[model samples]
Target: MSAKRMQLFAFFISVTLIWGCQLEEQEFIPDVSGIEAEVDIRRFDQALFQLDTNDMQPELQKLMEAYPELSTLYFTHILRANDPRTAPDGPAPYVKGFLQHESVRNLYDSVQVHYPNMSDIEAELEQAFRFFQYYFPDEPVPNVSTLISEYAIAAFVYGENDLGISLDYFLGQDYPYQKLNPRDPAFSAYLTRTFNREHLTSKAIQTLINGLVPPARQQRLLDLMVNNGKKLYILDKLLPYAPDSIKLEVTGPQAEWLEDNELEMWAFLIKEDLMYETDNRKIRKLVDYSPHSPGMPEEAPGRTANWVGWQIIRAYMEKHPETTMQELIALEDAQGLLDASRYKPGR
Candidate 1:
């Protein structure tokens, strides 16, 4: 062959190889249309806010009857108010007081304006749950509800089959979370940046994962990382359409930083021998919610180790496509999983 033709042939082969790798990395979107799942997000915030303060007794009774478990949970846990069923005066006084509070009312109004309808969120969750049913057909789908919890809880799974979302906590990034009285340090800019509609479905599915997945047997850094990785992998399966930034709970730049530094981070962990370390404080530095991971560069996002573990699990799954999610979760040996994963970064 002529020299020019040979170079062109080589270039074409290289292009084909790169394209093949990209296709392999693309998310595996399963056909979930055949899976039947329904998600109707009951607007508890509207019902509570629209109560008849002048004559709240009858309406409160109706609310209690309608949302038996959720109303009790709201009063007892979210609001810290006396349970209406057991209280001497019932929840009328407390409900009335809460409804009349200027700050609470303002918060509710903002929630309504931001989320005039939960149809979009409901549809996203329904799709996620359909994936859930596709993976685990025997598990019952939870009944979903939305509420404004005065910033107490973001998302929670209660009583085995109920999932609740606190809408006020997700009032977008532009909301003045810092201006609220008794400001919480947890509401820092880095954290609250994710407090928007884009993350609602991921957060809800994460809540369900927490409820379903068993806790790690050991407290070693590797165990925690692998445990969190299992959850993230399952989350990836459930939310195939969500970006890695949303799934990892990191900003776009942060996600890019992690991806770019994957090999460096892995080397750092191995050289320092930090994975088997079981100290809670050290583990928290690598896995907890924070601006950046300690002992790493400032650009490294918190939960760095968890992201590494997720990659390991991904590699392992790719290596063994037949391994089921249940089997992966039940495989408690973190070290074993890592060895089987053969996860060499930048390969």
Candidate 2:
């Protein structure tokens, strides 16, 4: 071939590669400007902490009035305190005791400093729920409320219309979670690394998604993967602007590792005959949160199988563009979905 022709060929290949990458990165973000969804964020933490200790009873009454269901959940479930209305000593003693605790007070103060204003979070959620409405127009958007759960819980969805976010759980990676409670296994470094503002919105949306998606009935590894993958897919649609690392609840390096080893990971799964493995203990190692996927390299993030399942779902959706989100979710045959995906990793 002529030198000029060779140069043109190389340039064309580069342009095609770049265009393909740009196309891959392109997300189909629907126009949510017309969606009439709004996030009603209540500062429950601020209100409860600012209550007057001197006149605690009426103050508690006012709080209960302001947040009837949430207040009850706070007392009974979150704090594990006696119900204020039915307790022998009433709400004052519990309120005063909680306020007077040195550790709890300090935690609340840290939460305030870290989250001085939740306007940014509120706006992000507003956009997410707008997308939610765009996808599930019949479903009602939940009211959001913030609290200081003292590391007890990160986020919770109450019934169909209320979502609570625990501010203390998201106090960033430098909050010394282990130092605060070394005995608690849940405060491990691998998990707490995600305890930051960047993960707040994604975590909240994940909680909501969990409530919306049906629980997996089959106990096999593939069923769990597809079930969790469906949830992740829905979450991706909801938080279209969130980073994949945040949605996957992994560090940047971990996310990179998953992307680089996609084919290897899938091969490992198939070679080991783990796809149909129904042992709960065996399945948990691959799908559950941990330092790394057991039996895989240290670089392989926990929930590695879940990420693969996500790719399968992505492949299926790409191959069958006519399948709607609702339809994809409604189709429960994991094996059939995998077969239809024709999911060749490098392709």
lDDT of each: 0.83, 0.82
Residue pairs with backbone atoms closer than 3 Å in model 1 (clashes): none
Could you give candidate 2's per-residue lDDT for residues 1-347 as a string of tens digits?
Answer: 54533443454345345543212446678999988767668999999999988888898889999999999999888776676555557657877889879988999999999988888898899999899888877677989999988888999999675799999999999999989788887899988989999999999999988877776678778888988888888899999888789999998889888888876777677657678788977779688887788789888888999998888888788889888767877888887787787665641
Q: Which pairs clash (backbone N, Cα, C closer than 3 Å) in model 2?
A: none
> Model 1 over residues 246-346: C-alpha lDDT tens digits?
99999899998988887677767765767777887777868778888888988898999999989889989988889988888899988778768866565
How high is the lDDT of residue 64 in model 2?
92
Candidate 1 regions with alpha-carbon error over 4 angstroms:
1-26, 83-90, 181-183
Question: Global lDDT for candidate 1?
Answer: 0.83
* Residue 28 alpha-carbon offset, candidate 1, angstroms: 2.7
Model 2 scores what on Cα lDDT?
Answer: 0.82
